[model samples]
Target: MEKTYLRAVEVDQWQTRQDITVTIPDSFDREVMASLPSLPDEPEKAVEWSGMLEMIGNASGVLWQKDAEVESLKTQIEIQKKAMLDECQGLQAELKEARDETHRANAAAALATNRAIKAEAWLQQVKEALASGFAPHLGRAPVERPSVLLAR
Candidate 1:
């Protein structure tokens, strides 16, 4: 009977390589070994190794799905952040416009107040001139008027 050596390769967490050996039984089914991608010489050990490989594949698939979900969430968060920033900028512009309008209103009110003050001063001058009997001399040809002399 020829002895066959079965090689098992295992990698650590750090990906350091290690080799394991198991003896093959002579009575092992050749048909089952042919179906497996990598043949383990021992029948019982082959079943265990195949199960472990299946588990590793399943775990890797789950990790990949989780990574994809994380990426999608990150993209959504970025989009929301950009929208919020745009809203803030719009509000800032509106605030600036409101401030400018308020300033313009204040300037208009000040001008109105100044014009009212000048009008009041002119009215006072007119009142003084009329009280002093100087209204007839304003912008017209002089007319002779009879004056009554009063004794004080």
Candidate 2:
């Protein structure tokens, strides 16, 4: 059995690309390589394994807090979206109601105009009958004839 140590180096400035060469204890490297998994990209797998351990140990709480915040924001956005949709529906209903009222008012006005036309026709018929001294047979007396003969 052998012991292996992990090391990481920091850079002072950003670089376009960076490569690291790791130096391992001679006996530790030989032992670790012998027990390695049979993966095609063993180097990348080794790096991922090291990262997983570090994340579990140090960054779990930070990741959990960020996830919770994101969920809270999503819930608030959904609530706001629903509120906006409800308001739009209410406005649409009000507009439809107003249109219905306008249609009813227009129909009433048309009916009133038709009634006025019929009343005017009746008045003209009555004027002609009075001028000609015509009386109905329904027990109604004749209307007074115009007084052109009164001067005689």
Candidate 3:
């Protein structure tokens, strides 16, 4: 059967390379490498498609390497996605805690403001009572005092 894939090259022909190294699970760094036949090296014999059939097996080997690289990339993507999800969850929890703390602080400030208003009202009432008590005697004569009570 003819191959569905085209030629795979050394270090792969993919223009974009991965920034992170991916080690596929269950693959302990074992791989196969092969070079396909090219133009005549010595120029002694001219052979075209006659012997190109032998390179089919080599092509399949290279194809496996490409497949492994693709699989590794997929695994890395999944891992990064999961990590981002976890970080988001943690940030959400922190945000919730900060909101709760803000609410509590606002409540405390309101309570303190109400208490200050009540204290100020009490102080004003005391001042009014003192002023009124002293004002009644402003125009009255001084009351006579007994000699016995003033002697001490």
lDDT of 1 by residue, 1-152 (tens): 32333333436667743445444444444555566676456545445544454466567557656766897999999999999999999999999999999999999999998887777767766565565566466756444443332222
Backbone clashes, each candidate: 0, 0, 0
Q: Candidate 1, overall lDDT?
A: 0.64
Give the TM-scores of the predictions, in the order they appear: 0.51, 0.43, 0.51
Q: Which stretches of candidate 3 lie over 4 Å from their true place?
A: 1-50, 133-152
Q: Which residue pairs of candidate 3 clash? A: none
Q: Rate the local accuracy (lDDT) of all candidates.
A: 0.64, 0.63, 0.60
| lDDT (Cα, tens digit) per residue for candidate 3, span 1-152 | 23233344445576643333322322221221113354466656644332353465456657767787998999999999999999999999999999999999999999998887777767766666666666667964444332221111
Q: Cα lDDT for residue 96, model 1?
A: 100
lDDT of 3 at 99: 100
Model 2 C-alpha lDDT per residue in residues 29-49, reported as the tens digit of each score: 446656776688555645444
Q: Residue 103 of model 1: what lDDT? A: 100
